[model samples]
Target: MSYENKILQMKKLLKKNNTQHVIEKEPILKPDVPNYAGIWQDAGLKMIENDFGVVFLLEKHYPLDYKHGAIYLRELYDAFGKWQQTQNAHPISLTDANNLIFYDTETTGLKGVGTHIFLNGLLEESEDGFTLKQYVLADPSNEVAFLFESKFWQGRKTIITYNGKSFDWPQLQTRWTLNKKDLPPLKEHDHLDLFHGSKRIWKNDIARMKLTQVEEEKLGFTRLDDVPGYLAPIIYLDAVKSGQPDALLKVLQHNEWDLLSLLTLYVQATNLLCEGIAEESATTYTNIGKWYADLREIDRSEELLQQVTNQYTREEAVNAYYHLGFQQKKQQNYIEARKSFQQALPYLQGRQQIIALIELAKIFEHRDKNYEFALEMTKQALKLVTESSLWTKESKTLRLADIQKRKNRLERKK
Candidate 1:
């Protein structure tokens, strides 16, 4: 019989065995037929089976002494407790590093029906050092199995991801719904999405706030000859169709590096925020100061802002002085506040300078009762606002009117 006739005969036999069996079985390639497990094993991936289906897993161990950039894996373990307390969620003390999981996923697309996660990467501290485990969906059919067998999510309190809150978690939830499976307990975990923190701390300092960009520029780590993330889905699909493990190996490597980078980024960010890494740039210090100010950590904010003021002589440092002055003024440290505002003047220009002058005017008039000095500062601010092109006519007029009123009040007091 011809090949087409034989295929038809096999379909008929399958229908006769179960007429309701309309689902076509995925074909195993010629190489895969002889040794199904050897295909993944040869690629250094181990096959694991569960109730739902089979998943390929790869595990790597890095020693405590292993350093990525400036941080040791052990330092990351040490910093998690402090980092957890600073997040917006209610503090759940994560002292044991084993309970913390750094997770990331590579999906087919950004969102909606067609997209599926092909790989899930997780990093956690182990007895020796750090262990990175990657669960690969060798076949799309095994995705449910992969999700079910993800024992790492069970009994773990904290999960750290770069942008997992908005993108990764939501995609997983969608996948669970599509598969008619319940969402994992990871939802209840103390999830820390580093994207928000990264933006708050490094937005001004970095060229771009992307994870890769942060890894390269801020953390001093870069991937060598790694596959770009955008090409991940394409490579994964080709691997699945062709039953070839080569492309999938690259995907796994890319994902493993991503997880490692996330661990390093987390450590670096925490160190900058909590332990205070020395020799940081002016903008980095200023951004951290602003972050602390937002958190109402007044002492930390002052310390970081002071560092920016003392170590740098640039436009960014002027903003730091302004923030420092504002914090000091809030604490009623009028002398230090006045000095900070004064120091900020030479570095500022246009609207910023005008604003600083107005602040100084207020301090002079209200706190020091130096009415003549206050009047002089107000007059200087009014002149700058009226002459400067930075402000709109209406804005300038309102500011000029406010400064003029201040000048009038100072004159009356004098």
Candidate 2:
């Protein structure tokens, strides 16, 4: 308030004397950002605008004969009869390929509040063929328009995805919460998340059940010059700041590749459910057999399990024998169950051996009513508890007491 105040007062007095009045300076407004869309016109990103805001749309059409991998694009439409035989009906009605949309998403992060979807890629079957459409969020602020425009599930019945049930769709739900007022009412559609199907089919066979790995192994095609998915968030965030859409263009291609793979993967996964077990691997036979058993399709389960046990011996498919025996037990086919469990005995040890012996004992006691065999099995289990060092001393003592009781019951029955 000392010398500086005096200088400011003199300056104000001189300025007022020089000018009759001081005009009010207008407030500065930020100019609209240009060239984010323009830079990608060569890359086929079309700026589509509506009431919500602007979204960058990139789309392509694959002809019917165009093959993504080993599968032609037409297989998605032509595989209807086989699709009808799949478990994808009822809950989702996957038989209707006409009402299908193959969907995938790339996000800023894995999960939680700050994570947002940057790309939503969808492929739909049309009369002409397959059309892949990718909607991009040019900036985080325009998420409303991005989601609004990319609600490709609006009229579709079932949306197929790799992991949309857990990750992608939940991210969309978070975005909808942020922009609910501007968005149209959400519609109900059955989700046929094929990630589960792939796991069921190839989890034991493949080391990692990642989509890219599956595409290379099962779909018979490897992605060339494709941007890694983990780098998507980084590439996109940099593009947002630098306004360089060139690097982001590769990410868009990665997304397109994902959508196309989803279509072919669906065809492959559905085929597994429909095909005969005779042509499948022992691993695939066991897998699909277990799947059928879980669905309570007893006949199909028994048939597939029987095939494995017939073709492969106990050492080759010990686990298969156990599954077959259990499935046989469920059907009250104890005669066949006894044979399978006996085959499993050679592969057993420790607690597993003890448990299998107890199961065999029960089959003999309850089904065969052979108390002598039951007592012998109980003695074997008792001997392990006392002799085997696989378990702790205290655990052995506890299990020893239980086996003693079982042996006493069997002796009394004998």
Candidate 3:
């Protein structure tokens, strides 16, 4: 079947399967299945009630020095403070831990309106440790009560997540929009999605950037017998249909690990951004330096990239020098930019080499008023492009035309 058609059927099943205000499935489990409220409470989930419906809630607290998967939860505080000072101390009050929400959600499906979050895991800090609250949608009918009573995020100042900026939070907003009544605005707050930072630091090193993979490979955390996320939809649906939540326990554990990982990854990421963060590989420095440059943290960017150029490998130095030069050129630091481009020349070839030559040529021509040097650089790039086999037929034609024009202009001025 087409993907869209399957989604339509799934939506129907989700809406129809809820026994309240919808058609019901014949009980999938034997009559011996424990009562829903009884099972949940026995499993450490409290029965939470509101005007809309009933939801299940579970809370666990961890002391400051408690280590989960190689990270101490308390270290995040200092890391955030350093970053806050860099942002001019924007009063986030992260030390309070009440200000930040380490959040994640487990959904019924990956996309579309059919997706409903069955579990919402939020972790915050207290005086000594961290508190995690997992809100459970006991049934589809209880979604409103679950979302509303999972405390509505009244005073939190920041929302931290793995990919919540693009997925989880947006999904929440969509749920609010669809439900469309008596809901607190899924309130706006400062957001630091660690997924982006993880990519900035580990894009080249990690084969996959999934949160679990990142924590395992980069943060030295591993889960033994952890439930895979893909099973969440099926497990949740079965529990709801069969009135059996035994399997859902593993799912909850999976989510708990996710929340803790976000907390640790954020600290490491901030540490990297602020104080070089534990001697990362040269490529990490190169990538994050370029990221900082893009964020206009030029000095910090230069500091990281500087480490890369001083490293032993020529292959490593090429990307670092190119980006450092580009950032410097953007700031009109022409001399430094020229030095960076020249330093990259020994390690570059093909398009990157030609591009660097052209950039240097432009700086000499316009900034230094050295027409002869400009013409020389342009001539070298033109010759290289003319004989290069890298470009496609159409691209080669375009390159030759542009380079010839540049060479002609430089020759006339020289």
Model 3 TM-score relative to the real fold: 0.81
Collision pairs in model 1: none
Minimal lDDT window, size 10, model 3: 25-34
C-alpha RMSD by candidate, in order: 10.8, 11.1, 11.0
How much is the lDDT of residue 115 in candidate 2?
A: 90
Candidate 2: the clashing residue pairs are: none
Best by TM-score: 2
| Per-residue lDDT value at 96 in model 1 | 60
Which of the two, 1 or 3, has more lDDT?
3
- Cα displacement (angstroms), candidate 1, residue 216, comes to 2.2
List residue ranges in candidate 1 displaced over 4 A: 1-38, 78-94, 181-187, 314-316, 349-351, 383-401, 407-414
Tell me the lDDT of candidate 3.
0.81
Model 1, clash count? Answer: 0
| Root mean square deviation (Cα) for candidate 2 | 11.1
Q: TM-score for each prediction?
A: 0.81, 0.83, 0.81
User: What are the per-residue Cα lDDT tens digits for candidate 3 across 1-414?
Assistant: 999999999998877767557545443221222257787788778887666677888889899898878779878878767866774222222444557779899999988987898899999877678899999888876777777875654764778888888999888877777765656666667887778778877778788999888888877899999999999989999988877778988899999999999888877776666675356777777887878777776787888898888863767768899988998898889999999998897788788999999999999999999999999898899899889999898999998899889888888877
Whole-model Cα lDDT per candidate? Answer: 0.79, 0.79, 0.81
